[model samples]
Target: MRELLYEILTSAGRRMNFEQTARLGNALGGLLWQALPGRRKLAVEAMVRHLGISKPEAGRLAKESFRHNARSFVEIMVTQRMDPRFLAEGVTFADPERVRFLAETKRPVIFATGHLGAWELQTGSLGAFEGKRKIVVVRRPKDQALHEVMMRLRTRPMVDVVPHRQAVMPVLRILRKGGMAAFLVDHNCTRDEAVFLPFLGQTAAVNLGPALLAVRARALVVPGFLVRAEDGRYVQHFDEPLDTASLEGERDEKVQATAEFYTRAVETYVRRYPEQWFWMHKRWKTRPPEEDGQPRA
Candidate 1:
């Protein structure tokens, strides 16, 4: 079952849904079943044996898995479009003229976002606010096919992408030339390098790249997001740059505080539309330190 699950996911030309993803989860159950050699899928077995759920009731829930996957996929698609009006239907920016402040600035700026709804759409939406400076999309490419598909969807007059790894040199060159380099550092894979901060009412690991860049390049570090609204229109949010000057030399304190600040800010946006947030990820997988310097489990 684990082998089958791996094959299915690795299979090109296959799009798995929530149901399929859960079936993969169930395949995890199948591993357990194989060890036991006497059980059905875990969810079914749990509902029937442990919870005493009727066969029909358990069957109904087993079928709803794709709902979770589809919702997740669609939300990501929102950020891939250039126009919010087209993807979000009713969403619009409160103030776009504000971007001139970012565009006209001679220094490079770092835009920080997370794995929130259709965030790639941000580079496209930046077109409305763009002057002459081009927006470079920095991402770790997934696959050749998906990369091309993403390129087609995200490329526009004002926007282009450079793979995140290759981006450092190109981005630095652009920064030297006063162009913007944008990225999301919500999930860094190092300890002490990134601080564990609260998001969605739990501890989340956040990277210090934004602060590091803003400090090194003297670029404005603007925390931004596409906050989902009650009207179902996704509003573009541009938080004024953090006061990094006040945080000078005391970078450790600033990095810790700034990460905490954005974590809360992102949490606020997530609370606005709880369903739009990616709840499936183990965002709280990182445990809070027992003490400030104590290693997290």
Candidate 2:
């Protein structure tokens, strides 16, 4: 049933132009916003708490976010069916020199990204920037059937997917060998695997995996975001890389610092483009022991 729905969406998406596809997605998203009242409330409350916006404004933003998210998915479905060259052409880098330097040196890189605009395409476009280096994305959908469908959609030369549960060693190996790994770091994480940090004006549990991998592999941590342009294209923005060499202290402390650094990077972009982020997620669901009224360990 899931696969059939995916096929139906992608098949129909392929036949339409970009604008038409976006409209169809927006329509579906509008229906979703109306149907999923619980999720809609969650999104609005999050925006109100984090952005300090009024309830009405937060509701408006939440609605737009839902629409943009739907459109992003539809865009990926349509664009993935097109030629790779065409997809590459549609993405422009904010700093081409930095990208060229990374490509030329084949430096091992860890892209700390979130569920921002056109996230799938953002990660996929790395193949064009780094010619032959391995590009592995750590992702695993809960639904196995959905995972298979996404794997097929995300198929590109030199690109692979490692289940998040088993991502540690494989990602480290790839990074240690001068390859690239992209991790979507915005989702809520389990308490055991997360570090509490301030994000979007509130305390949230941030996964330490990306920073830990960077520190372990001695790779550059680059905060990457793909933002949609007025012309319907995307601009790939790469912020200054966080160098692990400068971090000093115990291994755990260094990991904590790295996690904070990347969390700030993600916050900057999300603040600038609030509607482009995935707000329906319970980003602050995991509370620290102090918040939970438990004694500190």
Q: How many pairs of residues collide in each model?
A: 5, 0
Per-prediction TM-score to the true structure, in the order listed: 0.62, 0.91
Model 1, span 104-171: residue lDDT tens:
66767767776565465567556654554555645555666556555554556655577665665666
Would you list the clashing residue pairs of candidate 2? none
lDDT of every predicted structure (CA atoms): 0.54, 0.80
Task: Show pairs that collide, candidate 1.
Answer: 18-65, 19-65, 19-66, 79-118, 79-121
Q: Which is the leading candidate under TM-score?
A: 2
Give the per-residue lDDT of model 2 (tens digit) for 197-290: 9998778899988888888888888899988787977788989998886788999998999899889988999889888899987788888777
In candidate 2, stretches whose alpha carbon ends up further than 4 angstroms from where it belongs are: 8-10, 13-17, 79-84, 293-297
Residue 275 lDDT (model 2): 89
What C-alpha lDDT, on a 0 to 100 scale, does residue 115 get in candidate 2? 86
